[model samples]
Target: MPDDDATPRAPRPALADAVHEIERHVAGGGWDGPVRVFALVRTAAALDADPGLADRLPAEAVAAARADAAHLTSVEQEGLPQASSLEDLLARLSWPQTVDGVALVVERVVLPSAAEAAMPADPEEALAYLMAHPDRQDVRIAVGVLRDGGSWCAVRARANDDDAAVAGGADLVPGLVAALATTLE
Candidate 1:
């Protein structure tokens, strides 16, 4: 029912609901949701590192988690984020950090109530939004994480941007994690 090109999206605020739903899906226990959840939590951490990101949204960790769900969609398993706009965040990210401003973006939104919430609203628009964020030097942290995770499209966008600052900065970040992505992903 989902597609690879489908944009990654933001998650919502249904922690309890999500937990319950996941519990049912894997009533037997020892499910592998952590890998996906950790990835998003990391993304939120990165957003919190940015100074300007917080004023735009609070509770970034939640947002980051949802973004993670959207991204996990690529795997084509059960449960993910529902929002479409969040793809902008997902299509562009790789990690979230607990240090610095990354927390702001991480904690902004709420998660979904069930596995169905993973459904996206508008994949194309979300993808474009994610692509657009790294167009400048200001979103370096965001770009860095996304590029590191496996989002080559974000890396290419930054590498090819008109702004030398963004292009140059993006160039350096990916290499830092180049070796890591291969073994990590």
Candidate 2:
């Protein structure tokens, strides 16, 4: 039998595509951008509810929606209020029945497990330590979760900096996935 880790796992098609699209859109702006939030709605349902939307959306997207029942349309949420942290932003969010899911895109700097043991307790010192860590990686994670409990994630490292290098899976970032799921509930 093939090693499970070596075997590739496919994420839910609709959610995976939506998450990747959002990741690409965000990546276009380059790095060090603010957190972005998006509302995921079934494309067919949106078009059915508002036929005029078909005219405004891209022709390809409309056509894809007609071809696939599971296609999702991601609407970027703007004018979000400032929050103390990402968790606080998520905590203040609650999707309506019309929204089928939610997605978040955020950039973070991460250090190796070994470096955690030496992290400073003070917030400023911790920030300095992370910045000075030679092994740190800057990554942007896009996580999407549906009301039905399906989740998908896309991670792009600044070093790799290529769409082809972006990784995808259902549980790539479990904590972020769970946080996004709560917004749907």
Candidate 3:
């Protein structure tokens, strides 16, 4: 796989253009379906990639992004690949740069947060995805009320069981619990 950083990230779009696109998407908001989160965030990231586009996004986009994460997941699974290169798509959505840490956080943390309205689901498998991936982050901050003693957790390589990555649980489950509490609270 190519280095995400080295990849020509979708042409460093001009800021004004980025903002305009974001605003445009915001105006057409209320796309409340699976993958909505991804769409909503894409707007901001596009702007981040080009700050000039900030004025483009409407206020409603934030609300949509906050409320509809399941849709974001769907969008990532179904839409991103069709639109651009995975790196470009990921950049467009402001996905965490570290694939491994990102995978783990999304699976172990973000997924559970999304399910807050319904049954509490387990994100262990999701974490496993990150653990299995090669490009994992060495340290991740788990802040707020859920933080493990109000601290960040370091996810380093432990020489044991390279294959079995804290299955059914987070590598730093204790910190995860703390982080979740903060996020939920």
Top-scoring candidate (TM-score)? 2
- Could you estimate the TM-score for every candidate? 0.19, 0.93, 0.18
**Tens digits of per-residue lDDT for model 1 on 1-185?**
11144342222222222322222333223222221221222334444456464455446534644466422111112243443443333443333232111110111112234522443569786444444543322222212123223222111122333322322222233433343232223
Residue 87 alpha-carbon offset, candidate 3, angstroms: 30
Off by over 4 Å in 1: 1-58, 67-174, 182-185
RMSD in angstroms between candidate 1 and the native structure over all alpha carbons: 20.6
Q: Which digits, one per residue and each the tens of the lDDT, describe model 2 over residues 64-85?
A: 8999978999999999978999
What is the lDDT, from 0 to 100, of the residue 106 in candidate 1? 15
By lDDT, who's the top model here?
2
Please give the distance, in angstroms, between residue 130's alpha carbon in candidate 3 and its true position after superposition.
Answer: 26
Which prediction has more favorable TM-score, 2 or 3? 2
lDDT at 112, model 1: 32
| Residue 73 in candidate 2, Cα distance off native in Å | 0.5
Off by over 4 Å in 2: 1-10
> What is the lDDT, from 0 to 100, of the residue 27 in candidate 2?
98
Which 10 successive residues of model 1 have the least lDDT summed?
Answer: 99-108
lDDT string for model 3 (39-130, tens) is 11244345446665445545554444344421111122234344343233334433333111111122121223333334324668555654
Score candidate 2 by TM-score against the native: 0.93
Query: What lDDT score goes with residue 65 in model 3?
Result: 34
